[model samples]
Target: MSQIFDFSGNEEFYHGGSIYSNPKEAGSFLSLGIVNHVDVYFPNKRARISAPLVPGGESLEQKKQVSLDVLPDECLYEILRRLPGDQERSSCASVSKRWLMLLSSIPSADLCNKFEVVAEEGDEIESDGFLTRSLEGKKATDVRLAAIAVGSGGRGGLGKLTIRGSNSVRGVTDLGLKAVARCCPSLKSVSLWNVSSVGDEGLVEIANGCHRLEKLDLCNCPSITNKALFAIAKNCPTLTSLSIEGCQYIGNEGVQAIGQFCPNLKSVTIKDCPLVGDQGVASLMSSASFVLTKLKLQGLNVTDLSLAVIGHYGKTVTDLVLANLQNVNEKGFWVMGNAQGLQHLRSFTISSCRGVTDVAVEAVGKGCPNLKQFVLKKCAFMSDNGLMSFAKAARSLESLQIEECHRITQIGFFGLLLNCGPKLKALTMSSCFGFKDMILGFPLPNKSAPLRSVTVSNCPGLGDMTLAMLAKLCPQLQCVNFHGLPYITDAGLLSLIESCDAGAGLVKVGLSGCVNVTDNVVIALAKYHGGTLEVLNLEGCGKVTDAGLVAIADDCLVLNELDVSKCAITDFGVATLARSKQLSLQILSLSGCSMLSDKCLPFLVKLGQSLMGMNLQNCNSISSSVIDMLVGRLFRCDILS
Candidate 1:
């Protein structure tokens, strides 16, 4: 008899089998004394053949049947890569030793280039292995950045790393900047806010290594000096945007270096750099670095010479900010008036520049023909003449902010209200003491101005008449902020709330610090126009209580942000206020309110995942546990408490 051979369907090839058949096709009718199984038939005389009956036993069969191992490693790697985030991938890595080994071998996982470790309180520094892995014994010249949360995470292999913490990043003796200098061939952007320890050497190290760095924001990094800046000019040729906002040590040397090396520089913000002078600025402009489109020289000692340089070569400037440049005088304006190529200018902000008069501003108005935004704050010398000049030339203006310019009287702004040809969309004027009822008396357009939004805060002189006129004239007004407007009582707001819209579209109203505003107007607003009102800011309205809030909650289902901080409300009031079922509140600022501690927790927690931002600053009653409950692990909070 010929040796019987058992066949396996799963195998790609059969072992020691002369013929094969499936059981489903075979029938007992084909042969007697046989089950419904396959049988092989031979046409010629049978020949003797010797073969193993069951091949190489069960173990061989088991090994051959495992088809998962037969799939390509690349395919398996792709499958792993498709998983979301690290925690899920880490779980897959733990399934088996083979999976662990395979996952470890993946180049994407092996590189481990970007790691952010946010430290929780009581989490021991020794337990953080991620920092050790990132900083120790790695050779990656192409590595870009390794960001670690302050108060946690180690300074690892140092290619390019950003340390964000409450404490200053001191000399990296343990995991210091030397590691970055040694390993990182290129470092680009470094931001260290409130970091006190980073001195001149560490900054110099980054400047030397990161040749292609474009933006360097050292906000409040006070120890940085001209020496470090000199190194940056020598090493980083592509540096464009530099902000040393609070660095006191920077002087003329730093400015000269920026002019020489980074000729194509665009944006520069140097606030509170006391040593900067007109000569340094002149040197910067004379270096043929005319490509500067944005320049901010705040809190510097720049004078007429600096202004002349800017007018000569910086005609291509788009956004020029000279806030607190005390030395800029009326002569500077004459030079700026002759600027020929400043046609593309869009935004200009000059705040606290006491020397800037109507002359300089008028020159700016004339020179920059395409100006779209003009913000002049604390320019005490600015008057109606300057504002009229700006309004006449900047007919294409869209947004304007005039803050703390006490000299710009109501007559100045009335020019915009009456004769200005441009249609304004947004306007903000705060602390302008010259604002009076004359602004309201200005003749409205035959069809009213196309004003949509207006914010007039700390303008004490703007009386009720002005508010009424704003409501009547700006028919399309959708939002208004009348903060700290003491004279605007409920009478003005009543008119506004009643006539905001004939049927629909009135959305937001901010009446914070309006001392005379009462609950009657707010309640009336809630009852009549609740459907359209989305944001209501009644902060510091001492007279508003539960009655107004309950009415708002019951009526205005679309209310998203309700700033009733400093209002006279209890826990019950907060609960009643937040009871609106369809309210999708994203930001809630209840700062300075003593009643919103444990009282508002249950109601706030009911918001669940809908609330994204909340400000509980100065709220003395809120405990830490409430914060933990509201935020959980996914909280990205900005707390200054």
Candidate 2:
């Protein structure tokens, strides 16, 4: 019965006598990682006894299997507090009366991410800003505001509001924004996409009301201008982030107003505004007080002066994106190099600036210690020396894109991968003819890192083994685009699919101009990765026939976006796709498929409400009457013939 006895000293354990004698032998046997069962014996007396029952898994697991009778309310509350607010909390709240009672007692803020306001289908807000018509026919913003009004006073303690619209709902004019302004006072974030009618009057009202707004996105709202920006700065002083894209009338004045007023503005993205210029950028650098962490400006006419201002003031800038700054040269970049502010630069993108050369890039590489994304598109003067210098210096660079940079050779392009290949996640090199076969699949001495995305489209020198090598090395790749590689055959495509984790991870595969691709590669794709493939484009693959189409329809149940333009497929193949009940076919292109006729139209309507855009541009068989019929019947889907 001694507690401390080695196995060597215990003779009974050696002979399989009683296992309960020495506790040390039993503890040692149990410590050997036994899971299912353990054996301990007594030779003199034979007996069959059941072992102690182990605790079960976490399907409602808590202290003693989550029994309400066994645990106190405090312990139950603590366990529920650890559960995630969304699904786990909801599931626990639904389990029993006791759980429901406890969940009701917890504070709503701790139990939820954000109180959401979503307008139900067929629910409409009346012109007078009242809820009516199932809340469907009214403008999306109005209905959301009405929901906030009806829920818990105005605003309903709402933190996030999303008002998405279509043709059925009325356009979001000034009235809708005013409704949101009146109802949602605590709004912190708002996303307005596809609404063109929202102008300065409505935005001014929103700015006047939503003082606590931290994030505002006016993407595709082109009508707003300087007055609205001035109003926003005056009202929303706490605004930390703002995005204004595709706003036509917004110019230097609005940028100046935003910079002068919003002191806490940490991030600003002004893209596609042709009117913004160097003056606006200079004012921004001067008045914003250089507290910006992210800044993206496009379509701005700026010279070396703008770059100098940015380098001088933007010490805390992490992402600096400037496009169409044509006059910037080596001197501007050299001035920026001395700023010491760029030491924390993460993303540096300068496109359409042909004046930038290797000197600018070297200057940037020396200062940007944590540079992750380096993109220089249409920078004609950039060469191999500049690229290698940046690549060698910025050790954390994960993405490298060099488009239309004609001076880069294999030494620069491949040398980048040779040094930074282990950490590179995305590599896009297009129109670079100097990139050839040997560099792509060349073996590295160390373990290869998996790239998430790779686009070598229009690079003619790429050989057949390049894809196979990528298949072996980059298994996590989601998008592989070799759009104009005419010589690619089943060898590369098949190796790509088969080598992946059964090809289930691939999301988008583009082989548009791959003339040699045939049904064999498609069949391999359908066999392995049918469930996960989303966008499959074989636009110019002339060899794929009806058999391949049917195979894709049968296997690729989740495939929605497909383009078989100029392929060898006929009406019979398309009819098979039309009959597929599981596939949610959305954007389809049958352009240049000479064999497809009007018979395919009836089959296409079977897609019901899901089909959005259908292009039949070059099909000679479809009549004008059929096109008219398509326009009439499929009002929701775009028809092009």
lDDT of 1 by residue, 1-641 (tens): 11223533334343444353754233323323221121222223332222223245321112212223433465455454445544654566556545554554343322233244457653322222223212222221112122221111123322234444332222222124433432333345555555555577866766654466666776666767798889888888777777777777788888888879887678777778778788777777777347778888888888888877787777668888887777778888668767655677788888887767877777777787777888888888878887887777667678889888887776776666654545667889988887776443444667676677889999888877777777776767788888898888888878777767647656888999997888897888787678888888989998887788778777886888778778877778768756777667766667777776675778766654466667777778888777777666425543333
Q: How does residue 7 of candidate 2 score in lDDT?
A: 31
In model 1, pairs of residues that clash are 135-156, 135-157, 150-164, 158-180, 168-196, 172-176
Give every collision pair in model 2.
Answer: 122-134, 122-136, 123-134, 123-135, 123-136, 124-135, 124-136
Model 1 poorest ten-residue lDDT run: 144-153
Worst 10-residue lDDT window, candidate 2? 57-66
Task: Provide the lDDT at 443 for model 2.
Answer: 55
| TM-score, every prediction | 0.66, 0.57
lDDT per residue (tens digit) for residues 412-462 in model 2: 765565556356789898887765566444555454545777887787766
Error of 2 at 113 (Å): 38
Clashes of 2: 7
